[model samples]
Target: MSFTCSDCGKGFTRSSSLQRHQSVHTGERPFTCSVCGKGFTRSSHLQAHQSIHTGQKPFTCSYCGKGFTGSTDLLAHQSVHTGEKPFSCSDCGKGFSRSFSLQRHQRVHTGERPFTCSMCGKGFTRSGSLQTHLRFHTGEWPFTCSDCGKRFTRSSDLLAHQLVHTGKMLFSCSDCGKGFTRSFSLQRHQSVHTGEKPFTCSVCGKGFARSSHLQTHQSVHTGGKLFTRSDCGKGFTGSTDLLTHKRVHTGETV
Candidate 1:
């Protein structure tokens, strides 16, 4: 007695579930936000969105004291404290706290790029990645640091930059007592002790500790100088190398 979606052939236990699922294929959004005029397929989605205008967050996380408009968001946030990853990737066996994160990670294995940039036509696995890529073309730096007035495209970059102003080294390496502003930096630093060169060049079979190093090394094989200086017409394999070379003209000390 299960109801099936005619559009996608998806089975649902209830007829109401099938009707709601049909909206995905039909592009039907019966519920509309009064404030922003945003369309939603479900009334619950509209109600959750209305919180943005009303500034109401009833659901609060007990672990972090973070407020969310919906219970589902709070439940997902709670996983951070519990360290529970309910969703697991079938291809890589990597666990993600959110199902959407798991879905995005699956694209790495499948090589599926659904989101494409309208200006450059560059494909991305996630919509957020495409949005960030579009920012480069638009020259939009939305996130700004309050202290130094430094601007960044993403909020995470801004947060990491803020650590520089505070002079806070939260992550430390156990191997050499080296401190890092970010956890990722600490992880990369720890690789030096382990001698782990995970990123390998397909052309030369040379391994690198970081992916950026491997990308730069690949340019040597292709004889491509992607980053070029305008003042001296000096070409470099990597952006960092070109940036370092620019200091000679600027007379800036590192």
Candidate 2:
């Protein structure tokens, strides 16, 4: 006999399944994972949660040979190779492989920042992003590069930094055929060919391809002397000014 949940109107083959489904509405989680103290509505969900502690990934992708703890995770990973976006954003029409990813991306259009830092009033779109941002306040550099002994708060940052030590330029510009270690660097280089000056100076309205160039241009307006002559004790705005000033001592008027 089939059992049906009155609250959700969902049919289940077993009475146990119906009982488990009712727990969702009742806000009851009888089964709990001992490792992480995570509550689950059913024993099967608790069993699946235990795999996280055991590091057991039974599901393997046939396309890329990647392993996942669950079939749901494996199916999501397979979408990358197939280019199948099952989930889409209603606001921006952008597609994502996972529903959770689509939910996170939708926050961009909604301007909803659910995650916030406790130390500061700063907010982030994702909880993971907020955790990473907290490292700046905590001064926590947990992820370390084995090659260069350099440390970063996020593992992704360390992985990107490792590419610099390897000297491997995977991303290349099609216009100039110039290569870059990162895709962002390639995108910035491509802007040069497109003549897309995104960064603009507020003082003089001078446009620059890179933000660093705009920052250097802003130094001209700051009236702060960065370079100082050791011999004459005179201050200059830039290194070039210091070099030009040094010629007075050497008597080289070239």
Candidate 3:
């Protein structure tokens, strides 16, 4: 594919560079690796692949003293230490660990269901995220807790639940010393420090950690009557809450 350079009308020799230059026309990842079956858009990435096999960590961060195989990875890691989130969600003020994560999250706002589940009508922005969600309906427990032997569908969920037992707060906010098990929890906790209630109630000004929480809060303002047990007069926000609350009365723990 011979093409004229937009800069000086000079013709480029290689077709691959021409395609990458025209990723301006359509974003494409043509270059692929045989070993890991990973795809890349450029030859430089294929060369970078050698570092993973060679176990060569060339980049070192001064702040956190972390090593990375690539300088780009090191730079991205440094962003975590600096708390510099350049990319943000347009729909919500929620921040992300990386720009790619922010981009993936934007799909949630746009309702762009690109990654559809093969098993069901469900769709997601990222493939791995969809894979994680599928485990819930499938009743598949791949990760089990060592302490209590309680199984979890997703690795992150298992990790978070393990914290309940171990009390391991890995993610902590610098502004406030409040620590959380997961990065997401720490992020939500930071909102408390900043007094930034990003997600507000549509019916009321009440803010919550999640949209579901906001919905539950709205139900209260709407004066929506929640169902109570026939035998018990105990109140609950929803059926799920009522079911869980019933467990307490029944002396059941899962």
Candidate 4:
């Protein structure tokens, strides 16, 4: 007998197939992996899951030594070497390595917020993205480094921190052949070669590649007009500012 999905008019020959199909609707994954204890609804998923256990990044690039778990991931990683973006969105001409990334990128245009935070009123287009943001408020550093006791809020942060000890530079430039600790740092480091200042301040005509630098530049306005005391050379704005400023004179810096 065939198992019929009463909810969607879809039918499957096997009960196991029907059960696995239903999980997609309910967003439920009951099948658990023994190695990582990660759960998946499909057996093929469990097969693909095993690669992470062996650290088998067999998918190697022709141009770079960077390896990836899946072939598609290798293709994604290759785009960095050639700057060749094949997956272009028809909606925005915004390219991505995978179709899912293009779909996610489309959300920036449509302003769709599918994932909502239960603890707060905030929303996000992606569940993983919302998970990263929720970590900020909880002060929970779930990702830990095996080398060091340092903890980070995001997996990417932990990965970057690990580079300090591992000395493995995956992303490198073809022009200069210089490697960087993190991808963002490499992107910034490339600006020196290309002379690109993407981040700009609205307050002043001055521009910077990093937002933190722009923020510090904005403080220049508030940084000035600060009243400082003589001899100790303390600075403040108002009476309350002066009072709190007294804490430094009271040997708080020590």
lDDT (CA) per prediction: 0.76, 0.71, 0.65, 0.67
Tens-digit per-residue lDDT, 1-254, candidate 2: 98998875879999987886676455577887675455666677678667856868899999978788778788887886899998988875768889978977776556466666675444566655666766655657776789968778765577678888888877788887888776667877887788988667778989888643654576789865555666777876544566688679988665
Sorted by lDDT (best first), the order is: 1, 2, 4, 3
Give a tens-digit lDDT track for model 4, residues 7-59: 56679999988887676445466666676455576766666666766778777
Which has the higher lDDT value, candidate number 2 or candidate number 3?
2
Question: Candidate 2: how large is its RMSD?
Answer: 13.7
Residue ranges of candidate 3 with Cα displaced over 4 Å = 1-62, 66-74, 83-97, 108-123, 163-166, 174-176, 193-208, 211-252
Q: Which residue runs does candidate 2 get wrong by more than 4 Å?
A: 1-60, 66-73, 168-254
Lowest lDDT 10-residue stretch of candidate 3: 19-28
Clashes of 3: 1
What is the C-alpha local distance difference test score of candidate 2? Answer: 0.71
RMSD of 1: 7.2
Ten contiguous residues minimizing lDDT sum, candidate 4: 222-231
Candidate 1 local lDDT, 27-125, one digit each (tens) = 567998776455677899899978976879999998778899999888887886898999998876879888877976676556567666565454566
Q: Of the pair 3 and 4, which is ahead by lDDT?
A: 4
lDDT of 3: 0.65
TM-score of model 4 relative to the true fold? 0.53
Please, what is the TM-score per model?
0.55, 0.48, 0.50, 0.53
